[model samples]
Target: MTNISNAKIAILATNGFEKSELFEPRKQLMEAGAKVTIISLESGSIKSWDQKDWGESIGVDMIVDNASESDFDALVLPGGQMNPDILRAEDKAVDFVKAFFDAGKPIAAICHAPWLLIEADLVQDRNVTGYKSIKTDLINAGARFEDSEVVVDNGLITSRHPGDLDAFSAKIIEEVKEGIHKRMQKAA
Candidate 1:
């Protein structure tokens, strides 16, 4: 630790999120003494996609409509194929993501979660990494793609998969402690 005890992190997700992708980072961040809030598309708990089948559910702390980038020090986006796919379609969810990026707040997106970044046009010209399946989509959206455990561009953190959760969570903590970054206004 970087002493992120005062950092408040918002995890944005919805039904069908990858089980470990969401749980691992949240667990690690919480252990690191950061306040982590689970924000979702609805008020109730959201189910997870555990490996090949449906997994457990995690309670939602606040709906995307009620949460704001200003309320937290950073943002985390966990990916399952369906999670980001569904969230990217919701204007409120997408706007929530965009607001964090627009303010230069620390954001961590693992696996397919980068889809939300693409939808918000935040990945354009930014260095990023994600699950293999989304690499093409990221490149198509103008992100400088890399195949790695973690990639940190300014305050934007990205990783390949659940296996990289340790590095992913660590980056989020480190970035949150470093505070806001000065982001260039990438042309949309």
Candidate 2:
């Protein structure tokens, strides 16, 4: 396995992102030695949804239109009803997601965040799991939806809800480590 120190990971979300879903994983990834970048539709700050009320403000490292998929090791999408709903409408966000898929980079999406994956059309033929409500949407979009806490297919990893944060964070780190290892092997 490659050392995770300094590995770069990008998170895509906006207002109403599940506070824990975004912040918790971000904390874990950073603690594990990965640099986390929060990219959003706007370039200032994004609000989050805590359990009872709005949560912390996260700075926007880059605008979605300005971020290149080649600049990071993997992509993360934190789910909240409004977050993914808005993200799916942003062309840059969809394209960025497509870039990760086309480049074979790992992507971890949790809760309602998979809506962006469907918008990017990456769900077609991919096995995924998401918030229970979106299962039909995923199925209609050609994804093989599963009911699970965490589902990893190829480089795509997904989780069901905010409660799955533990599993979600662990899987993203593992994928990032594995991704770097595979890239190093190819370069060697």
Candidate 3:
């Protein structure tokens, strides 16, 4: 196995991201010695959605339009109703997710974050799990949805909710240590 200290991971998000979904995994990954960058729609900070109200804000490390899949070892997408909903609508955000997928880089998406995967058309023919509310959407988008703490197909890792953050974050670190998955397929 490779060392996690050398890994560089990216967490993509925006306003309304689930506070715990983003913070927990980030904290775990960082504690494990990986370099994590928070990518967002803008350069400043992005607000998070906790349970019912707006939560904390995290500084953005790089804007989506300026980030490339090649710069990081893996990608993470945190979920919240508005975060993925808003990101999925942005061409730049969708393209960025698609690029990482095309490159076969490790990607861990949790809860509503799978919406971004669907927007990038990366869930088709894949096994995934996300927040219960988006299960039908995953099925409609051509994915075999699994109700589990975590589901990983190739390098794509997904989990249902914040409760699965431990598995989600661990899988991301493991995948990165293994390097890019040798997954081959037609473009999305």
Give residue 91's lDDT in candidate 3 (0 to 100). Answer: 96
lDDT of prediction 2:
0.88
- For all predicted structures, in order, the TM-scores are 0.97, 0.92, 0.96
Give candidate 2 misplaced runs (Cα > 4 Å): 1-3, 180-188
C-alpha lDDT of all candidate models, in order? 0.92, 0.88, 0.91
Predict model 1's lDDT versus the native: 0.92
lDDT for 59 (candidate 3): 98
lDDT order of candidates, best first?
1, 3, 2
Best by lDDT, which number? Answer: 1
Question: Model 3 lDDT vs. the true structure?
Answer: 0.91
Count of backbone clashes, every candidate in sequence: 0, 0, 0
Query: Which lDDT value does model 3 have at 43?
Result: 94
Off by over 4 Å in 3: 1-3
In the predicted model 2, the residue pairs found to clash are none
Question: Candidate 3's residue-wise lDDT over 42-126, tens digit each?
Answer: 8999999999999999999999888999998899999999999999999999999988888889999999999999999888889
Task: Candidate 1: list runs displaced more than 4 Å.
Answer: none
